[model samples]
Target: MQSRTGARWEEFLGRLDRRLVSLGLVLFTLPPLVGKWVLPLTASSPSRALQAAVEAIPPEKLVFISSDWDAGTQAESRPQLTAIVRHLLKQKRKFVLFSVNSPTGPQIAQTTVEKAIKEEDLTEEQWKYGRDWANLGYKVANTPWIRTLSRSIQEAMKEDWQNTPISELEILKGVDRWGPDGQVAMLIDVTGSATIEYWYAYLTPTKVKLGLACTGVMAPEQYPYLDSGQLSGMLTGMKGAAEYFELIGAPSPELRVTMAGQSFAHLYIVLLILLGNVPIFLGWWQRRQR
Candidate 1:
């Protein structure tokens, strides 16, 4: 009779396990997908450091941004770029954008800037393209390209995205040459791949301050650069982007919702694991009573 009872409990638990799994999935899925919950925001130190570094650059200073991420990393890299661009635009700080690794990188960065300006309702006179900003578009993205660019900006990039002479662009006013002493106040790389390595290996010795925003996977391995002082600050993955959103004082509901989904998924998995072990616990309890 006891053996039969155990079998019954096992069967019931099997069914219960299946039901719990389904229930947990539903609970975790719906709220975030619908953006139904509000969660507290906490900005990590690295993210805050990133914002501080960018903010330290004076409005008169021009920043050089390397948009090394393609569409594959849009969810994370886009927000980082958008938030950074929005901040730069707001501060009236001019910046030049270029892409090294990906062909679509330049266009993606441009789109993000446009979206940011639109979202902020910025006026043409305030953040005018070609005057306040210039997109140098794509170029050879390797050690040799880096050497060429660092050696001479004019030789490396002669034209803008529209094929107009970069010499005529108003945004190139301060940047007659390359390196930290010229128009570039800093260099920021928002990348999804190994492109930051090139920046570190090539650009570190230059006077230009460097910063990074990369996917979570690449972030761990890249910490050594930070330790080596090659990277002034860094942002990692979607979490990093969300933290940046916090820093910019523009918290994104979509990001919060996604974070909620992630949190709930983890909790649900833990609950399922505990519940799955319940049958064994119950069996042990039964033996103790016997």
Candidate 2:
């Protein structure tokens, strides 16, 4: 009878229906995603520094945004781009958008720009295309191509994304080249890959300040660049995007929901860890009492 009871107890403790577990997880996680529960996040130094660097950009020269991420990394990269672009637009700064890493990056960036513009509620007269910004589209960013780009923007990109002559774009009027003495004030590369390495290797000496917004997995390797002054600033990942939102004084409801869901999921994992170990611990304690 003792052995049978033990078997019954084991069955109760050791087996859980998979569907029930799935349902429990969904129930546990969905509220935070759907509601306003958000974990408070303080802006880190890197995020702070990035915001300051962007703020310090001269109004006359244009900002070059190398939107180099595709849909795969949009979860992090899109927020980062939106935050920075929104800030730029709010400041009435002119910038050029393009992609060198992914073909779809430019399209994603264009969408992000439109979203920012709509959020700002700016009219066509206030923020018209070809005057405020231009999308130069995607290009092959090989070392030689980057080298040429560092020298002459006109030579590297002859036409805009719509196939219009770049020469006619009012935004690119004086932007014939890139460097400290040239038209672009700064270059911020938002990417998931090591595409920044091309710029770091080939275009580092031009005194055109570089910024990076990269995925979490790709962040650690680039910190040395920030510390060494090769990077003006950086946004590390989704957390970085949240911190940026804080700095800009615009809380993102979607990001808040996402972070809260992540926090609850982490708590669930901790709960699982405790549950998995408590039985063994209790067994050890009972044996010791014997």
Candidate 3:
């Protein structure tokens, strides 16, 4: 009778062991998949920060945007750029956009703006180009040009993206040429490179408020700027994009849904790890009893 009881106990332990392992595997693999359903995971905070920055932009003022990203960073940069432009458009702020890195920077910037416009259901007249905003397009290379432009906007950008002179743009009419007091209301830098450092050197001293949005991996490098208040705010990665979406009260279905899956996946793996550990503990305790 005692021997039969021992055999039954061993069989129960074996079943439990198998069940725990199976549960562990499922937990490890399932969260990321289910995380898709978890809307608004880690992006909420950064999105609010960006929204606050946008709200702070004075009415009818022109903001300066340095767009230094290309197709390679579209996964991160695109959504950030979209959110920023959406805020600017909603607030009716005028802006001047320029790019330093890729030749396609201007095109990408235009696409970002257009995408926002479409998503927001805004008409062209409501946020007209050349009037509401202007694209200086891809001008010169980095740092040196940024410094030179900080000193003299006219000299820095002789013509607009379409080859139209800045002097000829209706939106730029009567705007003080980029001189010392002729500072922009704000400066937004969205880039995939460390070119942000150059803006800090050349433009920050001018007292133009600055905001930044970069790829996920670039966020760590930007913490110093945020701590020093050199950057008024920032957005990092797809999570940041989702947060910005929420802040605008225009969350994209695809982004929110995808983030949910990621969040769930993380939780699932954590639970599975704990579950798997329980069996090992029990097994070890049983062996020590012998």
Candidate 4:
């Protein structure tokens, strides 16, 4: 009778374990993808700094953007790029975007721009390309390419990606000119690599204020620069992107869903960790020795 009762209890625990694992999977998977729950969102220190940096740009000053991310980091970097770009476009600030990180960076950037514009409920007549902003396209050989930009902006970027002469583009006409009195006011690098170090090494001397938007894994490498004042501000991964969306009062459910999924996934992991140690604490196998 005693043996039968013990076997039943063991079977029950086994069933409970399987159920818990299934529940964890469901918790982790659905929240970000389809969750409609309205959870509280608090912007982090870095997220706030990024918002402040973008807002501080005077209307007449031009912004230099280095878009260096590809699809692999699209989840985090894309939303961040979108939010920041929307803010810039809404503020009527002209910006020049280029990339040195990946060959496909330009195309990715173009798609993000379209998404941001679509969200604003504006028509092309209101925000035409090469008028409000321009894409310089991707350049090769990171270090030397960045150096070329700092040395002679016109020489490095003579034509927009559309092959239109940069001199003729309304947005680029007087900004980052070849001569000493250049108008490029700031640079924000949205990358998935170590390009921030290169930006600081090559572009800082030009007196262009620098900011960063990078993957969560790469963010730790940038805080030192932030501390030293080389980088004015930054945003990390999708968490950072969502924080920006919150700051700008974005109504994008897509971003909110992703953040919600991430939160639940973390909690599910913690539960798993606790469940994994249950057998050790209960001494289930240890008692078999008797």
Report model 3's TM-score to 2 decimal places: 0.75
TM-score of each: 0.81, 0.85, 0.75, 0.82
**Global CA lDDT computed for model 3:** 0.75
- Highest-lDDT candidate: 2
Model number with the top TM-score? 2
Q: Is 1 or 4 the stronger prediction by lDDT? A: 1
Q: Write the per-residue lDDT of candidate 3 for residues 254-280, one digit (tens) a residue.
A: 776655655555676687566545555
In the order shown, what is each candidate's alpha-carbon RMSD?
4.6, 4.0, 7.4, 5.3
lDDT of 2 by residue, 1-290 (tens): 23444455557657867677667778888999888687879888888988998899888989999999999999889999999988898788899999999988888899898888888888767898899988999998887888889888888888888899998899998687666788887899999889899889866888888989999889899989999999988998888888898898887878977878867877887886776566566666666777
lDDT for residue 203 in candidate 1, whole number 0-100: 69
Model 1 TM-score, 2 decimals = 0.81
Candidate 4, after superposition: displacement of residue 177 in Å? 5.6
Per-prediction backbone clash count: 0, 0, 12, 1
lDDT of 4 by residue, 1-290 (tens): 23444555556666776776777688677855764765677888888887888788777788888899999888888988997888787777778788888889999999888778878887777888888888988888456766787887877888877788898888887565421246777889889887777778887887677889899989988888888878888888888888887788775677777777777877888877776555554565546755
- Cα-based lDDT for every prediction: 0.80, 0.85, 0.75, 0.79
Q: Model 2 segments beyond 4 Å from truth?
A: 1-27, 268-290
